[model samples]
Target: MSDQTLPKTPRDDDSVLAAEYVLGVLGAEERIALQARIDRDPDFARHVEAWENHLAGLNTAFDEVEPPAHLKDALERRLFTNIDSAPQAGLARIWNSVRFWRAGAFAATAALALLAIVTLREPPSPPATGETLLASLVTEQGNTRFVVLYDSSAQTLRASLVEGDTPAASDYELWFVPAASGGAPISLGLIGGEGEKAPHVPANLQGDFTDGATIAISLEPAGGSATGSPTGPVVAAAPVKKI
Candidate 1:
């Protein structure tokens, strides 16, 4: 039997394009191309259907509002009154045009999609009661390495490695710097290699874990920083914010 390979499925980029099409945000040429694909390609048609279904729920949140009393009159004047010379043919032609309905649907769908995106992007509400502080530590290259959370009640600092490449033969030392400009960086402790760690926050330093404080991780020798102060290069740092 002759060896043959099936076509690869469309990537995430295609899904995004399909979503844009269903949202009516694609430009004229792009929309035309996608519409052609939807008509001929079953996979592309499914992608469009999926996006439509996913976004359909958002429509329920929008309550219908009645248009202004003069709006209908204005539309009639603008579209029909201008065709006084050939009133019958012109009015019928404009009324039968698919472009008019398509434009209205496009505008409505685009507005709904925009609202949904803005709503989704909003940050979640903070907890009701907590002396919790959180920070997202990232390297100089802007790559997130860890998510750090400090709980004042428990006097504990939790560090979760999200994404990063650890240096071989070196350890990561945690440090806390107070918000004050003259305050020095105090070493918290050496972070473990495991993906999750909850190190006890020193009682004396617990008071310093306030908002605007800075938490950092420095790459040090296996034994950790030699001089109490950070002697090695700082790998990631983030400012603590109260929740």
Candidate 2:
């Protein structure tokens, strides 16, 4: 597939596959498929290059130390003693005996490769700096009907309709009421019926979304409140608080 088909963010599977391909741990068939993809997909190729660049620095971190001469002799003795004792008729079985050692070595190499990849990958970005404001708009009976989150970084107001029952032929209009008494409630926007709705905060009214600002939802005629002000009864109201 082309780069446009790839996910916007690097996925975990893609990241692992890129690391494995860079480390030469993939089997013949898997390696072929990944290489083909890299040739056709620029994004995958970039990911592979990034992984290689990230892991290349680890090669100079430590000097290799040679094992003692007797250690190799002892290991060979342990590994081949059984093979040497086996019947001549079982010569074909020697390959089976060596498979475990090969597999063990491969596993160790793969593990080290994985550790290096994970250690060298870039760290996650930190969360946005400003405090997020939250509000739980509730009915007069004190039952929460909607949850609102104001993200100052994105300058958006997100409202989630927690209580599912939205009146047919009517719209839910959201309003922002400043903390100062006597300030008129400002029209924010209309929220969807059953799911979450994120509306961009008006650039002119961004300053109205401060702590202690109240959010209220009103049921209005279909299409929204007509007079630019809430014309229906306020169904739910809650004060904004920093979260």
Candidate 3:
């Protein structure tokens, strides 16, 4: 084909063009044209130098890891044996010929037939049964307030505390006080200042602890309540339903 009949180079805005081109991110025709210019002209090398400098900072953050022993061996084997220019040229010539394209169409048809048979023979799984709701407690400041999720019918509560956000100076304690009786509050467990925990509510007290019972968080000295009632001011309080 004549030079006038060949495809024209695409135009990019000059400011970002050189950066994008040197990053090996240009479309194929732009890459060919830029590479041709770099080969023939010395002045265009300055643009490439600027791109190299721009990308140098990015390399500092990358962590280098050694390749696996098997990968290195396989790469070395392929480097010496698999990548001959002669085979590549022969394959390209065959691909451009009519017979190779006809064979490719036949292979595609065979692949489609195998896929159809496999899909038809395979059976779909039955849907999973017995669904349950996920419950969580959170504070006004976007902090998670730890509490137990109770199976009220079974009168059982599984409790835990949120880690990291709790105060280090005092231990976070869980309290279960009957809302109706104003009765002596029972201590559930000592929750940590760090993370999630699972403590079971007392089996005997579980009968009296309704979902509407008041659950309170209070600061306690190292272990928990020495007395039968909370000594500190309520830092966090909610009904059992809050979880």
Candidate maximizing TM-score: 1
RMSD of each: 25.5, 28.4, 25.8
Q: What TM-score should be assigned to candidate 3? A: 0.37
Q: Give Cα distance to truth, residue 125, candidate 2, Å.
A: 11
Off by over 4 Å in 1: 1-16, 20-129, 193-198
* lDDT digits (tens) for residues 17-117 of candidate 2: 89999989979999999999999999889889999998999889779899899999886444322121211231111121333333423433444456547
Worst 10 residues of 1 by lDDT: 87-96
> Which stretches of model 2 miss by more than 4 angstroms?
1-127, 142-144, 193-198
As a TM-score, model 1 comes out at: 0.49
What TM-scores do the predictions have? 0.49, 0.44, 0.37
Clashes counted in candidate 1 amount to: 0
Query: What is the C-alpha lDDT profile of model 3 across 58-137, one tens digit per residue?
Result: 98788988888899878534432212122112111111223322332343344445655685687853543421111233
Best by lDDT: 2
Better structure of 1 and 2 per lDDT: 2
Per-candidate local distance difference test: 0.63, 0.64, 0.51
